[model samples]
Target: MSVADIKKHLYKAIEEIDDEAFLQAVYTIISSKMGPGATYELSADQLQILEDRREKYLKGEGKSYTWDEVKDRIRKKDGL
Candidate 1:
């Protein structure tokens, strides 16, 4: 879809949402992208770490979990 169409749909969807926390999270994300300081620069070490992880994952040597799995692990750890 076009950017304009996507934005129009987002506006309508956001208007229908009644959850304050969900709206706040959306607002936070939007503001971070829209505001100054939105452009992030990774330090040399941080970039190297990310590159290393990507290489490992591409080689099938890095373990990964789905969002549901991570949530389940967190809940189990917290006894929630």
Candidate 2:
């Protein structure tokens, strides 16, 4: 079957799940299969840009938002 077919079946299976313990186990299995977070090596230019942004933030030249505020704004913007 195609990836789309597999995804549709997976979605249906997820929706039909009723046992909380089984569902949690399924989540753990999927998380393990997906492995760890991604890693990237930044180039010198990218690193410099990030450093500049950090310096600006330290100097209070840019605004910072709390995680909750950011998530709320994102959810509202996306109509989630």
Model 1 Cα lDDT, one tens digit per residue, 1-80: 99999999999999999999999999889978787867567999999999999999999999999999999999999999
Runs of candidate 1 with Cα error greater than 4 angstroms are 1-37
lDDT of 2 at 45: 100
47: Cα error in model 1, Å: 0.5
- In the range 1-80, model 2's lDDT, one tens digit per residue, is 99999999999999998999999998788877775753346899999999999999999997899999999999999998
lDDT of 1: 0.94
Task: Estimate the TM-score for candidate 2.
Answer: 0.50
Winning candidate number (TM-score)? 1
- Enumerate clash totals for all models, in the order shown: 0, 0
- Where does candidate 2 have its weakest 10-residue lDDT segment? 32-41
